[model samples]
Target: MSEYKATYLVVGGGIAGVTCVESLAILHPEESLIILTASSLIKNVSNVSFYAKTIVKFDVHDTEATSLHKIHPNLNIVYDSLKHLDTTNKVAVTESGIQINYNLVCICTGGIPRLISDSRKCKRILGIRDTESVQEFQEKLKNGRKMVIVGNGGIASEIVHATRGIQKIWVIRDDYISATFVDPGAAEFLQDTLKSNIEKNDSPVLRRHIFSEEDTLVSLNKNLKSAALGPDWYRKLENTRNETGEQELEIIYKVEVESVIEREDTEFPLDVKLSNGKTVQCDFVISATGVEPAVSFTWDIEPKFGKDGGLAVNELQQTSIKDVFAAGDVACASWEHAPHWFQLRLWTQARQMGSMAAKAMHSKITNEEVLQDFCFELFTHCTNLFGYRVVLLGKYNGQGLDQNYEILLRMTRGHEYIKFVLKDGRLQGAILIGETDLEEMCENLILDQIDLTLFGDDILNPDIDIDDYFD
Candidate 1:
């Protein structure tokens, strides 16, 4: 067995792991570090443009792990899967039989999609997460006449919007569309766009920032991990080919997939039974239910887990185990969350958490104190839903506030939708759909804690330039 040593070691090559190693390399140039990943590529953030303190736009690129060697001479990249982590001895053993002794270790293993069906052995049922899953779905979609998408999150939202030509049936647990991101008003606006065939500006979809390898990654094992797809993963690849001129869209609300049964006598091989006592035969099932932290490798170390099945981490991103830290989707913040800030598994948080975790690790080693990042002050999300720019700020859904908040809304069919959540006459959260150009001002208002009792409903008036009012 070969043995190696590094002053710092990180597992997983997703945005979190890559950002952590890059930050450490910059902060401690004299120290040597290693990045261990199961995948052949590492996620890199490029073309970043910050609109506010925490709200930013960026693109993700999948780069070859070997090419990262040029960034820092001391940064070593190991292409191996972690099998066991010994927190007491500070040793990590990989599937390749390499034991790595590390001074400090950060777990950035990301997450694995929670499968809806127990029969993962079946090729007909699929879960979307990495490029491999998308490819598998694409191959199946070629001859697929019908597909049942189960879930009401970003993944399912994008899939329904991107996939045309197929008879798409969505199984949403919530009554409204994109319920994870928007409320009913915004959902209605998006739903209207989804039903209308008014051609979207396909030009913007062409301006993608994805980079992939010619040779796909070989699965290391059954538990091989990969980074979740970032924003516009669907826009980059549009598979719109249907034999029928009119695409059929159906929504089964407030229900879930009860069971998926395979049948041999039908043209469609699968029959999906719903909780609402309905069974539909479809070509395949797309399970975007959600994800669980990829922390199975840490069973030996036994890091404290949160209710969400993620490794419980302090504000410093340190796990319960000494000298072990976790970031990205794998780490769930155990500290009391800031009023405006709540955790949502997104690319933005992954990058931020990874960078902050590096600083926390460095400060611990140097005996220095570091303040919590301002990014944690408020939750800001920017993404596209139904070909519309969607921005969510602070308590977008009035989460944790109970019935104490008030809402103000303004919507124009086929144009824009805006909603503001106010508590005690202060802007607590806001959702801006379409090119509202109000995200910056809304974010600032929420951050400044300015009272807007006098403005009332006028805050959303189209004639009033909200940016000028804030300035």
Candidate 2:
């Protein structure tokens, strides 16, 4: 075993891991650090792999930005996997038999798709984890064939819509779609959108939905456990449907594959056995089932929790073990107020946790100061779904409800939904879909900690203008 030591052993080179290491080096230039990753740096990213894709969010992204990183002498990407973590000994072992001793270890590996071993008849399926996969699917789609997408989250829906014109079926585990993220009212609107699309030849419906279990499914928060496909994926269903009783492919939901057998003499199609006790033939099976943090860690310590199990910590985002800290998608956090759920997920929370943890670790700041700076809304998560910018602030729908915050909501533009929770006139949390003006409000409520109770009943009205609050 090769033994090494560093002040910080930053495991996983994803966003949170990257941010944390960069902050550490800048803050404490004297500290030695090492970064671990399963693959080499995302330099030679191709159009077919999923790990590295050019995020097209930037207009005319200078693709040359990665070239500059290639020359960074200190930028070391350890091509190794975390085999074991001994939080008690403050040591971690990698797949390559490298044992590392550390004062602090951070895990920011991000996530992996909940996989299905069974292929059934779907052969050419892939998850839309990154740009390479999407571009690859795009190329294959040009040839035109039937494809079945499993699961009904944003990724599954996005891919379904992106490949709609080329024949597609949305395989949902439950009836309808989106059961986890959006509200019921929004879901109703989404259903109407799908219905309208099908009527106007904008999309096609193979059937209402397929179910793995019985008619009704229960969610912890009564939110849709699933229903409503984003416009991008379902709208394409219209193009693939035949109006004149032509042969049709299948789009199943709520059904699990009991078995998947490899097909002979073809690079495509997996023989899939369904949970419904039926066999279906599919050319491709894309699984968007869900994701778990890609934590390649197993620790033996008094730390009370592993990667899948969230960590228990105070506002400081410190783990059960002290001197040893955690943040991003690995640690758990709770507050004295309402909706106090330990979280180790989401990009916004990851960044905020990284910043807070960095401050807490520095000898300069006091714990009280760090705790005071810790606010739940600092964990603001936003995403672009089906051309709509949706932002979720704080913990809203979950098993744990903290009475410290209140829920405020309104109908934004058409299908867009907006909701915010306040505590003592100050904004604690919010969720806004579509054009609810999140860019402006998120900054105010989170950064300024403004008391908005003065907005009065106008808060219920979406017509209320937002420009006055900027100052």
Candidate 3:
């Protein structure tokens, strides 16, 4: 068995883990740092741009782990999966029998897709998470004519938009699409955009190299779970559109999958039965139904866990165990959250948490005081949906407000949609869809909690330049 020692150790190669290591490398360039990951590829955040105060936009690149060594000479990337964590002794054992002793450790193992119950019994059911799984899905999609997607999150929405020339059945338990991100009004505003077959250039600037044969072999032989796909992951997929330009789509709302039936005599390989007593035959089922925290390694003493099965961490990103911390989807915020801020398992939050965790760890080592990051003061996220730029700020959908908030809406049919949540005449949240370019103003309003009752409904009037008025 090989023995290694590091002043700082990080687990996982996703955005959170990589960000944490990068921050640590900058903070302690002379100290020995190690990153243990299952896959040889690591997610790197580049070309970062910040909008307003907290909304961040960045390009995610999957690069070879060896590349990081060149950038940070003090850092080492180990291709191994964590098997055990002895918190008492400050030791970690890998599946390859390599043991590492570390002064501080940060776990950012990320999450795995939460597939439907019948996924284990059926070969036609698939969950898209990592690069390997995405490749498998693309290959399978090439031969598939009809597919059923079960989920209402970003993954499902991306898949629905990226696929063409094939029949699609989108099954959701909510009445509206994208319930995870937007309210019903926003969803309705996007209905036409979703139905339009007009293709738009939605590809992001990808700064990654082509996979080599060695990379393929390593991916195939990997025993530990691969890291979750990062932002705009679907854009990398090869569209399996045939020569026919005709596209077919059907959406079944307010229903859940009751069971999956396989038949040898049917033309379609599987039949999906819904809770509404309807059955749909499809070539395969794609489960984009969210994810559960991936905590594969066992510890001498388990850390506190949240309801979502994630390691519960306080404002400083410290777990219950000493000298151990967690971030990303694997870490749930257990501290007193800001009134408008909440936890969501998104790439933006992952990066924020990762950087914050590194700061906390450094503070602990230096015996310095550290405060929670300001990014957690108000939730902010930006993404593209159906070729439209969507910006969500604070309590965008009036989450946790319990009907005490008033809504102000402005819609221009196909052009733009804006919605605001106000409580006690104070701006609480806002959602701007399309090229509204109001993210900066809205973010300021939410953070300032300015009273807008005087403005009344004229706040969203298109003729008035609210930015200047507010100024």
- Cand. 3 Cα-lDDT: 0.83
Residue pairs with colliding backbones in model 3 are none
**What lDDT score belongs to each candidate, Candidate 1 first?**
0.80, 0.52, 0.83
Q: Model 3: per-residue lDDT, tens digit, 302-361?
A: 889987788999998999999999999899889999998988888888999999999998
- Hey, what RMSD does candidate 1 come out at? 8.4
RMSD of 2: 8.6
* Candidate 1 Cα errors over 4 Å, as ranges: 197-227, 240-246, 298-301
Write one digit per residue (lDDT tens) for candidate 1, span 243-348.
Answer: 4435478999989888999999998999999999999999999988777898767446577888788889988899898999999989888989988988877888
- Compute the lDDT of residue 270 as modeled in candidate 1: 91
Report clashes for each candidate as comma-separated counts.
0, 38, 0
Model 1, TM vs. native: 0.91
Report the CA-based lDDT of candidate 2 relative to the real structure: 0.52
Which candidate leads in lDDT?
3
List TM-scores for all candidates, in order.
Answer: 0.91, 0.68, 0.92
